[model samples]
Target chain A: MKEETIINFTHHQTAHCENGVVSNLMKHNGFSVSEPMVFGIGSGLLFCYIPFLKVNHAPVITYRAMPGHIFKKFAKRTGIKMKREKFSNPKEAQSKLDENLERNNPVGLQVGVYNLLYFPDEYRFHFNAHNMVVYGKQDGRYLISDPVMEEVTSLSEKELEKVRFAKGAFAPKGHMYYPISFPEKLELEKAIVSGIKDTCKTMLAPIPIVGVKGIKTIANLIRKWPKKKGIKTANHYLGQVVRMQEEIGTGGGGFRYIYAAFLQESGKLIGNEKLIELAKEMTEIGDLWRDFAVEASRIYKNRSRNDAGQSENYNQVANQLDHIADLEKVFFKKLKKAI
Target chain B: MKKEEVPQDKSNLESANFRELCYAIDENGEYTTANSTGWEPKTVALNNAIDEINDRIEDAKKRVLEGKTSPIEYHMELHKMDVGILASYVGLWQWRVKRHFKPSVFKKLKMNTLQKYAEVFEISVDELKTIK
Candidate 1:
């Protein structure tokens, strides 16, 4: 293997190990455990097999939003009927919005109420609901532009029309319109877990063999042995030497370059001792990513209760994977410099 | 009771003298019926009596334009006779025009200057087309 590639793999392995520790710590706390769920599952399995995947800094929960159905379910479960009250008139809605604004709350916590009115030339079946997404404290309200889908793609307008016009409690078309088909809940959860595992594995690929004849020759000699037997023995021998080199390089010019870049981005500088402490703290990134993946997968699984599209599920997983990749890049760059 | 009757007698005599004075002014004609406070006829004096009525009308108009008056109150004052006359003043036309064209922009426009500008420019009726 090339020296840089071997070094990169070593860093990746170390990052994964650190992530595992952080995951355990997080589990010990009130937070959820990092199970082999979502894209993290495959990544976790790969890390278990390889000795080099490593990272720093446990992932922190940054953003979350309530899905439409989830919010509806929550309201139902709580028996909180969200009745549409007469807000005097359209003008009064603005005043109520203003009144709510004086109470200091996070922008995300604000409730947005909207009146869905259809305009001319729009499809009756695909009518866009005018929505208001209230945000900011100065009584500022922003209109949310996204629309909620009320029916499935398979159901025709005629079928929907019958539902809309249907009367009585037993009306099938109006009361319960299925938007998407869902798999068995357990099966859906398993699939989501498997997707997470695959993502993590892809992020930590095998170290490339080029440029360093010495390491490559050794790796080649090891390859001659049984695959499983050789990998374990080779990693053990290589890991020790790599660890020592990393320690020595910590005080060198490479460390200064990493620190300077980090300081510039963060707008905070630390002494060498503090920098070392931060570096140690960051070693938990892999574990945090694992936890994030597991939680995200669980959320997706819960969402599967209501029929959701394959593309929707895929998009959710893709977003988590993107976040994981971003974390990986930061960890790798730092580790590469440290080595 | 007798002492109370003496004060009553004095007031009655005073009222009698007042009635005689009214009669001396030819109160026997239709003017007699018109002279009583409640029975008074509507006259030109009634209109002229309210000297500051124009000012009150202007005030009410300004308040309505400023959004200080509720919709119900605005319509009520707008329909009032004296206030309606103030609506004829050049200032009211300017106020209405400024409110029509650019509400926020005209809100800052001085009342006096706006009235003068409307008169000098001969912009009648405060119509949207006339403002341009």
Candidate 2:
């Protein structure tokens, strides 16, 4: 009976609410746990738990990459051509600038030169590259100005002068252009990190219910008891479920509704035998969810470390998450029989 | 056709010469070789000519260091003047030391030293090949 309580507690509504607590824990640990957690929870439920519940729903996955052809109309509307060039040394890649400058020269006659430095490479793509200076020839001598000076104009002459006079001043500036402003870089970095955080938050959305499989398992065990004790034990399990639902609702109202629906639908089935089986199946599903959440949390930690520039441990953590997902699929097959 | 016309033409020439002299003085701190190479008068004048050319080269070098004149400018200026020719001449004077020297050697030296300068001038290595 005690073991059933533990299992039911682990597999009930309150388990999902633990995500908020974990998020606060992440904050306390000084790591931005927002994105990976969301992605983990949302993806975990979609890929792991939804099939267990026999819910016919499809999950949408979004990632950062080049836009699809549907965006071609928007591209024409914006009149912006996104083309990129690669150079070993950004400063040494004179031909690229010369070619671009020549193409833009006719337009420059009216609007000034727009010799923007572009980072077309995936690794070097950054917003800061918009502030770098572009150098070219006017008449028969050298000329220099901000590459994206037309777009962002806060770059001061003094800053340009300082860059012009720096050591190895003749060395070709690299293709990875960064804005002259540190504040801009910081802001851009934060936005990028925030996007990743949001994704994590979405992934972890189903965790509260998944976290409390113990209560569900206990409910099943109580239903299996002698008729005299069964009512009392079942009432205790009901009380636990209600409490778990309340906790989950307090943290995030979404899981509360989900749990309530699960209870309402399962309650309509006749006989204690069917109820016991449903509880048992839910308990198993809850355990898988808990395992998935733990693994997802671990993966998030590793991904956060990777974002912090630690690549060595990232692969190992990713592999572990893959293994956990595979395990969930197996459990999902078993839970589907109950449905 | 008159005496006045002759004096006017002579004055025009003199003014042009004076302007050239002033430019040289401002640029090289000497006036003797302002109009043309002051090499025919004597060894002192010939030495002064060399000194003035060297002064111009030194100024160009300083500008390169200061990121003012780019490598393309330096290479182009080298083509416009007789500095490389003079350096080759001096190298020939020490034939024993310069016997193994070749045009390729000079090219390699130029590329290695002036590559950074060319980058500053926004001239690619491929473009630098077309300069000569």
Candidate 3:
């Protein structure tokens, strides 16, 4: 029997793929940072319900920032350096990855979420920007640490290449990244303050596409959907909203809970009790988001629940979201003063 | 959002094929974690996506039977794609993919092109040529 050939890599199942990949990469470089800390330093918390933009013919609603932005922000905040490369040709990309693996380098890659065969069919979509680490090759299959998976998995070279070069909607173009260096020690004081301010700016942005206003916009959109698209079609939209929020990439309550964990960790790192209290408030806000998902899902389940009851459910969701928005608003404001 | 309403069915949570742990608040507003088997709210999302693909497949099958479109069309819809998306995956242009959607063009397509589409759908070319 052929023996297994996996580079020394620790697999950690994290709430978000980008956070997990970045954290794992840092750990590979001897920097011990938690997933939540990576997420926070990257400033992964934000909201935008852009009706103008569409994915798979539906309006786009992103709970987190754009792909690769978080990793860039994290590196900017912490003094870590990484080498990221994208290949135009799949053959060259394959050779580069093989060369890296031959040197025992565990490389991170960008892949489409849909073509990953190991993923449940129900969970697959046309999303083309999922992140994972490729650590080894054995018998023409690649060992992978997909942060969203419960365990490390392996895929054939053909399967990996298909996902890596998946077309349409944020094509990865064979992108790969790994840290080149890490500072002797991480002084998170400046990084924490900067991350908090970054989040605050996103939350407070007056543009209609994002932040508190975006929540209100989505609520209003959901309220009108039942009337606009009819109950059945509207239910599909609602299902997709929560799916984007929670289903894709360990999303539970739109990463609000993850952000809370970051705040708690950051609080401890800075030794500020008030930040920890703020973390509690953020957790409560995360619950409010989950509450919206539950009520919205209930509405989706009840197709014939009548317009009045349906309207009431949507109103409750909108009201809860608004409440959550207010809480985050205050939370960021207080966070600014806290630090 | 009443914390009480959050599910706590230990059996279901444990028996679920794939469960995820999400950091959440407990009933006491404490920072307690929850083990979600992705059973409740996520099921609604999962079922909806499945239904959408099934509906598309049904429509594509109907079109293929009526000779209005080719199996390539059905296969594309089965994979939940449009002309532009398929074009990108197959390294073809949008106009060409639109042309290939016709039964006449798809029937005359060379083995190389058919192989590309087959690899995308992860099926044999014979399967791609014939309706299942």
Identify the runs in model 3 with alpha carbons over 4 angstroms from their true place. A1-5, A248-251, A303-308, B1-16, B25-34, B102-115, B124-126
DockQ of 2: 0.01
Runs in model 1 with CA error above 4 Å? Answer: A1-291, A294-306, B1-132
Question: Which 10 consecutive residues of model 3 chain A have the lowest summed lDDT?
Answer: A302-311
Per-residue lDDT for B1-132 in model 1, tens only?
011111111221122221100100122111110011110111111222122233445665566566554222232222232222223323355346434335455446566545544443234324311211
Q: Which DockQ values do the candidates obtain, in the order shown?
A: 0.00, 0.01, 0.42
Q: Per model, how much of the real contact set is kept?
A: 0.00, 0.00, 0.40
lDDT score for candidate 2 against the true structure: 0.28
Error of 3 at A241 (Å): 0.8
Sorted on TM-score, best first, the list reads 3, 2, 1
In model 1 chain B, the worst 10-residue window by lDDT is: B30-39
Q: Write the per-residue lDDT of candidate 1 for residues A1-339, one digit (tens) a residue.
A: 111100000000011111222222223223332311111222222211122321110111101111132223322322223322223243444434334333321111111111122211111111111121222221122221111111101222232222222221111121111111222222223332233333233333454321122223333333332233333232232222222112111111112222222322222221233324333333244233333334333333322233334334434534544454455545534433431
Summarize candidate 3's per-residue lDDT along B36-71 as a digit string, tens digits: 565477676667667767887898899988888889
- Cα distance off (Å), candidate 1, residue A339: 4.2
Please report the candidate that would top TM-score against the real structure.
3
Local distance difference test scores for all models: 0.26, 0.28, 0.80
